[model samples]
Target: MKVGILDSTLREGEQTPGVVFTMEQRVEIAKALSDLGVSMIEAGHPAVSPDIYEGIKRIVKLKREGEITSEILGHSRAVKRDVEIASELEVDRIAIFYGVSDIHLKAKTKTTREEALNVIADVVGYAKAHGVKVRFTAEDATRTDLNYLVRVAKTARDAGADRISIADTVGILYPTKTRELFSYLVREIPGVEFDIHAHNDLGMAVANALAAVEGGATIIHATVNGLGERVGIVALQSVAAALKYHFNVEVVRLDKLVSVSSLVEKYSGIPTPPNFPITGDYAFVHKAGVHVAGILSDPRTYEFMPPETFGRSRDYVIDKYTGKHALKDRFERLGVKLDDREMEQVLAKIKSSQGTRYFRDVDLLEIAEEVTGKVLKPRPPERIEAVVSVKCGSNVYTTSVTRRLSVIPGVKEVMEISGDYDIVVRVEARDSTELNNVIESIRSVKGVESTLTSLVLKKM
Candidate 1:
């Protein structure tokens, strides 16, 4: 059976503490997910507020208008009112969940097992009667008694629920236990589609989800950037890449994964960790000498999934661990070729530069010029200076432009001066060609309107 994804970034992910999405952000995220070809987008829990209800309705409208191909689903509790809120939106599917484990039933819901079963059946039946698809989730299912869980699943199915979801609410399941649970349910339940909603409390969400898929789960619940209540749920980027690269299961459009993830990261206010899998800042960056050398020769040597598969590019960090091969490759990419002697000098200078964290393309170029006693281009000048003036739209733009300009290789200083120009920039270059290139780059900045440059004939 083909595995499907139900992205719950809007529903569960928003439950992350201090995380809230505007209605516009919710619709944008839903559209991004649909564009990425997700099987379903759990828009949000409409019972939370009227604004959220309207947002879900808008997503449904988008789907009906053929703007988004994926199905729109809404979250609900195993209560008549919650299901009613979801049904009013006319969503494609309604995901209704109830606490099933002994602890949850005793303390959380304060209801008996039989009463919980009735609630599930009533809500599932009500949602089904409305002709919208129903997915009945057993919250804390992994922690529940197996026989009782089976009975609950049967109750929902007999009442006409379309699917069953087993939630590892506390993220306690490892791969082995996850496999056993799904295997037993698939064998006993017979013909009912099982979905896995694994959390990351113990940091095993992705692993357990995959194990569930192995044991016959047809759908997996995920959130972009892994945003959720506590430690969050399975990350969509991690699971999608793992499924395709490891199990050869093609679920969503891998190319759009990064873009979708970035959009979520931007709106959710949750920064994707540098070390996060697949779409993180440093996920595809190589640093060590050996690894960089291997990557330079063949990326497959150190990288299992190519960055391009997820619309990301691979980069090598130039630091103390950098190898000559990596340095040479970087130089070649910048269109600067260094001879063997010049390469050594530059390498030695890089190694000797105390407390240097890393080098950018411009940094390397400056180093090469310093080592060779010549500029990159022929006919080097003794010294070149230029004064640049910038007109910015706002204080934010002026501040941002000044910060970016101060980091360029040849820039001496940048000041936010008031007059006709919002900022004045001073740059020193080894040659006229380098001066022109730097000035053009400064003019190309997003906020810069125009610039006037004057050469320094002599510095007293």
Candidate 2:
């Protein structure tokens, strides 16, 4: 079965508390999503703020110019004014939402069901009248009575809604219930495509989304990192991966998933957790000895899906759990042939070390050299350059700090600078580990309050 994806990273994703994207960031994200191949991009609510309206306008302009290929969507309430505002922006589709559940209708909308149905008809018809496609969302549809929800959906369809979105707003639906609900909707409301917006409050957004697909939902609403209000919604990457791997449906450019995810992560300022699925740092990293051994023999033994499928690579870490096989493999990869005794001694030394639990490549190399009593060829150096801004205490003399910083091993140039920071230092290091050491040494200077580092990716 085929399913479409409607990415709301700029709409629902911005609703994440304390999250806001600059106009440039919004455009960049939209372009990335377009390249990643989502069916539609819900830019933002045009009526909410002038900035949001302007962002949507710029994104719509990009779509018009063929810079982005995905259809742009606008969000609105089931009010004429909302639809009117959305209409002015020229979005390909406008998604209008209203509470359908009794709890929401009575407490939030303060209207009877009959009156609410009238509002739906009026706004949907208004949007359709403007020659714009319409999508009607029954907010809290999961908690609403099934018959009433169907009535609301049918009312929208009759009023010319192009699609109906069944939102599990509070994440109350499990897999079985989600399947049953969408199954009924597909049966009751024919001729209109259905979309599923599953929240992650109960931590089943991806599972429920897959269930909705099984129940015949043709579209799934998602965000770049599952970012949305409260606990957010289903993740775009997880949904795409599940669809492709489990259901044999391909809907997106699978190789671009991690790049887009990283783009959103950078703009949102919310770091993706190391253990997050699909695009996380440790998702493809193996640490345990048995797991690493199995992975070395055949990745399929430990990994159900290969990292290369999503433009990622498998990684292994050496720790106290390191086994002889893993150690030998590491040594061989490094072009160092280790005899059995030398390998055992190195492993024993690594396990007994009390400094840190995980050993870096440099640390392992040093240990191997010490244990083998042989001068191993030095690995090729990696050049990394960075600019660090240092903040100094008010009472401290800046010159003394700069002088001390200038004497640090990797410090190439140190200059006292005005503005937010007292000193700007440029340094080059062999690798990230060495770069971190340089930064730590800079922080240890007496007058330094704090330091911010920006790596130089390319030089003009």
Candidate 3:
């Protein structure tokens, strides 16, 4: 399956209060993320700091040194300096963001629509001339007049935007509306690639992402753990999962998802809640007795997928909702079964009885035997590990998981995986003593935070 993941943690993730990454930290995170298998990395906005130039430079160096196959990109405004800085850094791609909606054009840029179009022509053309692949972002494009959005995107394409991103900057679009708008843009415009950058203000980021894709969007802009301005942008985990699990698209390495999210969390200091999609701690965990039972019998029964498909493991959370049917169902494959009458009897007992029922396979059989004349024989389950692949254009991802992973540096790589936690990495530390130096250096990457490193048996 193929889906691209953009790390805005440096740009947007840093926007979270009290979140700051030294140049070293930024480099560390970026390197780790590159190893994690995201197709693209939005390194950061060079316009934000004097050190940004140095940061981008270091990122390019790290990517090259680590043999990272991912693309390195920089963000800019639709202006000369923004494009100039990215060109200076030699980044492969540059995204120039501007407000095209009438409201932003008037309030933020204070330029008329014609003036804005002129700016687009001038700046975007310049960036292309400088030999940088361009992606022009019409900020808040969803709210802009359709005709105007077309005008701006066409102008950018004419100026040589390899692609144009239609942004729902305020997260106000519904899935159907998003599909309608993007489909119109797709049918109306044929050559240039369409991209979507949706926000999560209304908790519809994933829904909108899928809608845009259906409308012919080939690229998606997302942040780790959905970190960004206001409610955040599309989440790397959510989009990756949708593309992989729901649409059978391939642009991500599902096995590396957790490893990627953890790094973002540590660097950005914005934790993905337990329930966040895909990478969230509870995303694949079964807590209810019924769910747990289903998983125990056949993971696909309740999960439709195994956690390992996404670099995660399944977990069973004990709670007050346990039921004997659930208990029996879970261990049924282990030659455990309860007759229908016994099943109803157990339910009645539990409904009236107090205390928690912690069921194990043995306990289930014992209960079954007490009610039945014969003892049930134990049998090994007929377990199978199978994969179903689909062909979509040039990508193939299972429609079940958003697998993700990472390379390592203690304290840095572990934190930026986004959405949730997963430990998967191989760090290159020269020695135990220099691990601190490794830590400091690793922290410079964009999404790195914690390391999953152990002391070496012997330093080479």
**Candidate topping lDDT:** 2
What would the per-residue lDDT of candidate 1 be over residues 64-92, giving only the tens digit for each residue?
99998898888999888888889989999
Worst 10 residues of 1 by lDDT: 377-386
Q: What would the per-residue lDDT of candidate 3 be over residues 159-265, giving only the tens digit for each residue?
A: 99978889898999999999899889988877788888888899998889888888778778777778888778888777777787787775677787787787676
TM-scores for every candidate against the unseen true structure: 0.82, 0.86, 0.72
Better of 1 and 3 by lDDT: 1
- Overlapping backbone residue pairs in candidate 2 total 0
- In candidate 2, which residue pairs clash? none
Name the lDDT value of residue 334 in candidate 3. Answer: 64
| Candidate 1 positional error at 376, Å | 2.8
Query: Cα lDDT of all candidates, in order?
Result: 0.87, 0.90, 0.71
Q: Cα deviation in Å at residue 401, candidate 3?
A: 32
lDDT order, best first, reads: 2, 1, 3
> Which residue pairs show backbone clashes in model 1?
none
Clashes of each: 0, 0, 61
**CA lDDT for candidate 2:** 0.90
Q: Rank the candidates by TM-score, best first.
A: 2, 1, 3
Candidate 3, after superposition: displacement of residue 326 in Å?
6.1
